[model samples]
Target: MSPNVNRLRVIALYKELHRLGRDYPDRSYDFNGRMRRMFEKNRHLTDPEDIEKAIQFGEYIKSETLALYSLKKYRALKRMYPSDDKH
Candidate 1:
């Protein structure tokens, strides 16, 4: 992929991560700080292969975070309106 495309993808991932951090169940600041540190740690990477790997890892993290949040929401909903079978 082109350098421009890679940069854009990185930026998009950064924004998405930060947006999701807002809804983190606890330690929002800690999460955000860790996210920023992860990016910063890779800021100097010049190898295309390494950068691509980082991007893929970031994407994976985003998906996992989404799934976890979804599960949490589902659990909350269940608690609020448990199934009749349980009763």
Candidate 2:
């Protein structure tokens, strides 16, 4: 992939991570800080393969975070409307 495309992907991931962090049940500040630091720490990577791998990893994390958020929301909903069929 072109360098421009790779850079854009990284930027998008960073923005998405920050946006998702806002709704994190844990400390948003800490989550955002860790996300920022993870990217910053890897900012120096020059190898195309390594950069691709990192981007893939970021995507995986994003998916996992979304799943976790969904599960949390589901649990909250269940608590609010618990089933009457308690056995």
Candidate 3:
């Protein structure tokens, strides 16, 4: 699977966890750490397939379609250039 897919999964997990009121900082940190490890392990792969993954993970699940579209656009940009690329 692509890095983006993995990231999307992690993001979804975090979101779900937050929505369910699971441990906030801990869950987010754990997911982020896992994502980092995966990136480091897959250093040979391309940057990441962020766009497709973000879309698949419902990055634009807002109540309004406009908000969803805006989220999609924003996520598209994010997928192209994620902020947490320390790996």
Instruction: Tell me the lDDT of model 2 at 9.
Output: 100
TM of each candidate vs. truth? 0.90, 0.92, 0.26
lDDT of 1 by residue, 1-87 (tens): 888899999999999999998888887458788999999999998899999999999999899999989999999998998579865
Pairs in clash, predicted candidate 2: none
Give the best candidate by TM-score. Answer: 2
Q: Which regions of candidate 2 are displaced past 4 Å?
A: none
Clashes in predicted model 2: 0
lDDT score for residue 69 of model 1:
96
lDDT of 2 by residue, 1-87 (tens): 888999999999999988999998888458888988899999999999999999999999899999989999999998998589867
lDDT per model vs. reference:
0.92, 0.92, 0.50
